[model samples]
Target: MLSALRLGQIDRYLLGQLLAGLVASTGGLVALIWLTQSLRFIDLVVNRGLSLAVFLQLTGLLIPSFVAVILPITTYVVVQFTYQRLASDRELTVMRAAGLSAYALSRPAMMLALISVVTCFVLDVWVVPSASAAFREEQFRIRNRMAAFMLQDGVFTQVSDDMTVYVRRRDSDGTLHGVMIDDARQKNAHATILARRGRFLPSTDAPRVLLLDGTRQEIDHQTGRLNILTFAQNVIELSSNKSTAQRFRDATEMSLGELLHPDPAVVTARDRPKFVVEAHRRLTAPLTAASFAMVALVAVLRGAFQRHGGLLRPFIAVLVVVGLLAVGLMIANLAARVPALIPLIWVHAIAPGMVCAWMLFVPELRLGRLSSLIPGAAA
Candidate 1:
């Protein structure tokens, strides 16, 4: 009973270390990645005068996807590093001397691997998809419906490729003193308008401006004659041609069920394979964490211990993981092209872990069996 309790205490200590290392390493990498990724959206802050809070909120939605992508790799890294440290410190030797088997020593790492696998599943299946959709929707709103907010005093803002709006002065009350618009959205009937005053109207789909006491001037292409019309009030929509139409949903924004059973009208035959591949990718991707953990265990726990620590096995494990990542990418690409090959994604995700687990633990099990078969082995 005392020996069992001691073994449990050791397991807890090992598990605590693995958990702490995994969290610290994962967080640092995620922050670094977030900084680099957020650079792409710096224009919103520099050019559009977006607030820091809003900018962070807009970019923060991407965190879930980032975590999902890096969790498996980080799991492998943390496990490999922790076990290597243990071996170098001769703690693993002490555990082995205490009659702990390979499986017993690996229990904490396997537990951590299981935790990582569950986390990856939750992020990939639900959190990432929801966050991706929200991110795209927020981005769409910024580009289309927020054109009115982009306007500034004494500056000509290009609301769209063919439209420009200039405000002579803007008041604190959201009123424009003098407004001018150059509209060329129509190929044949390009119009320019001058307004005495204007105010932006709230809209969900596009930005709308209501002008008071405005004069519209346009030249007729057919007659080659310029026409001018004066009006008390006029409403003009400031939206790009793309914004006027419906936004198409990408694979990242879709739930697994939606990806698997997509609307035939919305999804083309060419895109069906891509959707299927994405669905399967999300399902199988989390499994790689367990496989990667096994690889790390095999690297540190398998083979004979040298009196002098050697880096060769750890280096080889790193190379093997890199090769596996490359192969996984290649398989995903190939499967996307050939739908029949989708099964390869599951095989790639699962086969490595199974092989590594067998390599690491089967010999120990064989030895136990042979010893049990011999007389007086139980004693």
Candidate 2:
């Protein structure tokens, strides 16, 4: 009972340290990535008149995707750092002198890694799909419905592929001054209109721009003919829905069941392979945490102890982990092209972990005695 209590205490302490490192590394990486990516959306908040709360909601929905990608890497870092610290402090040496096996030393880190694996699975299976769907829906709304309101004073904003709108100044009463509109949606006829002032008329469907004292210049593509019309007032129709009626739903947004047996009506025959590969990828991705943690543990604990730290083993451990992840990604890509390669994903994810576990544990035990238990070995 006393030995068990001591072991429990040690495990708790090591688990705490591992958790701390995992949180810190994952949070910092996620924050760095978010900062860089969110710069692309700054126009939405500053120029598009989107509220800060809405901006945060849009950005926050992406956290699950980031966490899913970073969890395995962070798990490896936590295990490597925690075991290296224990070794550096001679705690591992003391434990070994006390007759604690490498398996015992690895238990805490393994537990932590298992927790990370479970968390990653949850994110990959459910949270990621739901968040991705919500993000696509919200983004579609912003691009199609609220684009006109995003126009900034003194800046030309491309509302869509073939349309650009510019405004010099927007008055307090919502009147726009020095407005310019270019409409090239038609393949043959293109129009550029310059107006002294304009206001957005209230409409239920399409965007209506009421221009005052404007000159409309229409150019014919077939002939080098330009038709110019001077108007006192003109109302131009703008697209309210720039994107197609189809909502964007990628394989990443599908549930595991849906991805495995995708509806033929919803997913085309050519795209079925992509969905199947994604489902397999999600299933295999979480196992990388355990594989990575085992790699870190074996790197530190399996080798002979040195009075001075050696960089070779730790560097090799990092390379091994990187190779595993790279192989897994490459195999996933190939699996997307050829469904027969799907089994390789599991092999890439889990084989390293089994090998590392054997390297860490088998050397410490009497394999000769275990082999002697075989019926044919005695004969």
Candidate 3:
């Protein structure tokens, strides 16, 4: 009973240290990246007059995706840093001298890694896709609807790739004065319009602007002739950035089931491979937390401990982890090209964890023989 209680206490202490490191590393990275990424949408808040609440909601929707990317890396860092700290402080030495085996020493970190893996899995399977869908929906609404209402007086605002609108004045009653529009959506024709007064009209499919006392000057490309028309009132439809009139959710926004069993009618031919790739990526991504955590544990816990610190060991671990990440990315890209490579992605994710676990648990496995396989292992 005493031994079991002591083991429980040790596990709690180790888990707490790892959790602290995980929270700090993950929060700092997420905050830094969020600051840089939020700058991309600053124009929406500053120039487009979006409300603070709306801005916060829009940016907050991206947190799940960010967490998905940061979780695995942070788990690895937490394990590496916590174990290294314990070793450097002679805590690991004291524990080892107390007759704790390698597996006993690593049990808490392994359990923590398993927890991280499950968290990552939840984010990958559900939270990220739902959040991504919401983000895209909100973004489309802001770009297409809110931006139209943000039209400033005497400022040229681009509504779409082929449309630009300039308003000299906006009345309290929502009427526009001295409105000018440029429409070049057509390949063979370009039209420049000027109106004395105009008002925006709401439509479900396309947005329209009503202009009174307007003149439209159109230039025909084939004949190269300028045709001018004066009208008492005219309605102009603005082209949208989307190719199809209906908005289609991207693969990244689809649930795991939808990605795995995509509707052929809804999915285009070009997007089929992307869906397959995304499905495999989701399956493999969460397992990376386990793999990365194992790599950190094996790197630090193996071999003799230096009195000061094992700087070279951690450095080599970083290099190995970086190489693994590079290989994972490269494999993902290759899997997208040739479906045969898809299985390799799973291999890359699982093999490292298995290998590291063996090295950590098996007393027979020596770091010396593995030195030849890994360049800096001997060092």
Candidate 4:
């Protein structure tokens, strides 16, 4: 039992090393994507004369979303790398000779996989959904206030070609009194309008504008004729702006509870397959950590080599893992088109489990003694 404990410790230590490397690499990749996406929004703010505060706040909110997306693949990668490295070294050979087998080494992986799956489940079902929604809503708020904030660079900003919007100044008072509108659209047509004060309200899908109360001077471009008129209140449309758009599907952003109990309307006829795929993928993400743990062991922890090709075994193991992932993705895509193929997710999740099981049962892969129970027990 003491010897068994020692073997388990060694296995765990090796696994930890692999897990660290995998998560780091995956996390780095995710961070890079996040930065790229953030830069896009940052550019938008810069062109619009918006401040840096909103920019940082918006990008910071996107981090958790990236974490959910990258965790699963990274978990698998680390395990595969860890196990193969042990196998390539005669360390595995020594352990096996001391009566440890593939199953023994994989025990650590199976246990860790369960932990990883749970983490993923919590991230997908809870953290990510809430963050995404909050981020989206905040964006809506920012766009709504975009015009108001435009008063930052100067007391006023000319948001439109013919309109000059001005604020006497900003203080706790929230007062905006703007004057001047130049209408020069048609040939030789021009108008200068003034207002006592104005209020800005954002339209859902058009130019952010303000309502003005004052007088107007109109000139007919055709004849250069001038006419003066007065008005109580007139709405002037500002420059058109677009809301932030992204490619992420609803499934990618929903919380676990939401996935399980999506609004019936949300699960509409056109997008059912996508939701199904996403829901199942979330539940199964954790399972793969365990499965990969085993497979990584099989690929890397098997075979007692005399020369110990340190990196070769790991590289080969990673290749196997990558191939399996590719197959899994292909199958998942096919399944999406045909839900009957939904079994593919299970297949991908379980393939590694089966491979690890095989390694546990086979003895030739490792130079090790058979346990006392083997049918052809060595005397």
Which model scores highest in lDDT? 1
Write model 3 residue lDDT over 62-147, tens digit each, in one string.
98889999899899888998999899999999887765566667888888888888998889888999899999988876666753
- Candidate 1's error at 185, in angstroms? 2.9
**Root-mean-square deviation of every model:** 3.1, 4.9, 5.8, 6.6
Q: Write the per-residue lDDT of candidate 1 for residues 1-379, one digit (tens) a residue.
A: 5556766788899999999999999999999999999998898788777778878998999999989999999999999999999999999998878777777788889999999999999999999999999999988987886676788899998988999999999999999988999999988889999999999898877889899999999999999999999999999999867788899999999999989998899899898999999999999999999999999999998988766777999999999899889999999999989999999999999999999999987897778654322323434
Q: What would the per-residue lDDT of candidate 2 be over residues 224-274, giving only the tens digit for each residue?
A: 889999999999766523464577588888899999999999999988998
Candidate 4 — which pairs collide?
A: 84-300, 117-286, 125-256, 188-221, 189-221
Stretches of candidate 4 exceeding 4 Å from the true structure: 15-23, 44-56, 84-89, 150-210, 213-230, 235-249, 255-264, 310-316, 362-379
Runs with alpha carbons beyond 4 Å of true place in candidate 3: 202-207, 220-225, 239-244, 268-271, 364-379
lDDT per residue (tens digit) for residues 1-379 in model 4? 5665566577668667756776687779888988898877875487666668868778878887677666666766766655556656666677767765566656656656666778777877778777778787776656545655566424456544444556554455544555555544433445677777665664563344444568878876667778878888787655332332332336766765566566676667556676777777777666776776666666565665546455665666678767876887787677678988887798788777776677666564454445522422332
For candidate 3, the TM-score is 0.90
Model 2 CA lDDT for position 275: 95
For candidate 2, the TM-score is 0.86
